[model samples]
Target: MKLKDLAHSRTGDKGDIINISVIAYNEKDYPTLEKLVTVEAVKKFLGETVQGEVIRYEVPNLGAMNFVMQKALRGGVTRSLRLDKHGKSLSSILLEMPLEINN
Candidate 1:
């Protein structure tokens, strides 16, 4: 399965940092996401796009996880030559992450 099957994501940018929030559709799915989605996993998924540390904050009550990626914007939106400087599409890209679904 893909992460998108269980959750939706939103993204934001600040300077060279990127913030992505994954919110589970159902509360029951939150635990699964919490276990499967780690900072290292996300960092690896983003690859060279992310040049710095990846920090994850769990919001158990909200059934969400927020990932703060440092140095991820290629030096901020204003300076970045990349077409998607804001990295809004990154949220969708993250949804493509493969998952092992256990029914």
Candidate 2:
């Protein structure tokens, strides 16, 4: 399955940072989300796109987690040549991450 099967995403950006939120469709799925979406996992999943560290902030009350990736935007909107200047499309890209969720 894909992360998108159990959750949805939102994104924001500032300078070379990318902030992504992965929110579970149901609170019950938060554990599965936590298991599959680690900081290392995100770094590996994103590859070289993220040049700096990725931090995961748990929002259990909201059944969500926020991933703040440093140096992921390549240079921010005013600097990068990338198509998605604000890196908004990255949420969709992250939702495509492969997963192995068992019900």
Candidate 3:
């Protein structure tokens, strides 16, 4: 599924929270994310890169998952002075992630 679809799946408009959806193209990619991007890993990634609490959830319908991050933008605005807080770049980072799954 596309990121737009994923974002739409997240039904929240608090502005403080940002949710991203991701889907793996194959089985190999699936396992990589499971092994690499754990809850703590996601938290650390978002915490350092963003200014909020990151929460990730698995969704079977889309063969993907959702990441609901809080306070990602500094000053609670899309354009934060913080150099590291650009949510648009998250798509690139997530694309690099491979999802890990086990039989």
Candidate 4:
């Protein structure tokens, strides 16, 4: 399975920083996400696009995690020539992360 099977995501950007919020469909899945989703994992997944650091904040009460990625926008929307300068597409791409389904 993939993370998308358990959660949905929203993305926003400020300057060269990108913020992606991954919200689990149920509270029960929050723990799994907390364990499997790490700042290192996200940074690795994003690869060279993320030139700075990745910070993850857990919101257990909300059953969600927010990832703040710095220097990820290829220099902010106004300066970038990339079609998806805001990095909105990154949320969906992040969702593609594979996960083990332990039933």
Please provide TM-scores, in order, for all candidate models, with all chains considered together. 0.96, 0.95, 0.58, 0.94
Model 2 residue 61 lDDT? 97
- The lDDT values for all models are 0.93, 0.91, 0.54, 0.91
Candidate 2 on 1-103: residue-level lDDT in tens? Answer: 8888989999998888989999999999998899889998888988987899999999999999999999887887789888888889989989999997666
Q: Which sections of candidate 1 miss by over 4 Å?
A: none
Instruction: Please give the TM-score that candidate 2 achieves against the real structure.
Output: 0.95
Q: Indicate the TM-score of model 3.
A: 0.58
lDDT by residue for model 4 (3-103), tens: 89999999999999999999999989999999888888888888898899899999999999999989998899889878999999999999998877576
The lowest-lDDT stretch of 10 consecutive residues in candidate 3 is 1-10
- What is the TM-score ranking, best to worst? 1, 2, 4, 3
Lowest lDDT 10-mer window, candidate 4?
Answer: 94-103
Give the count of colliding residue pairs in each prediction.
Answer: 0, 0, 10, 0
lDDT per residue (tens digit) for residues 1-103 in model 1: 9999999999999999999999999989999999999887888888998999999999999999999999998999999978999999999999989888677
Q: Give candidate 4 misplaced runs (Cα > 4 Å).
A: 101-103
| Model 3: lDDT to the true structure | 0.54
- As for candidate 1, its clashing pairs are none
Which ten-residue region of model 2 has the weakest summed lDDT? 94-103
Which candidate ranks first by lDDT, i.e. highest? Answer: 1
- Model 3 clashing residue pairs (backbone): 29-98, 29-99, 30-99, 30-100, 31-99, 31-100, 31-101, 32-100, 33-98, 34-100
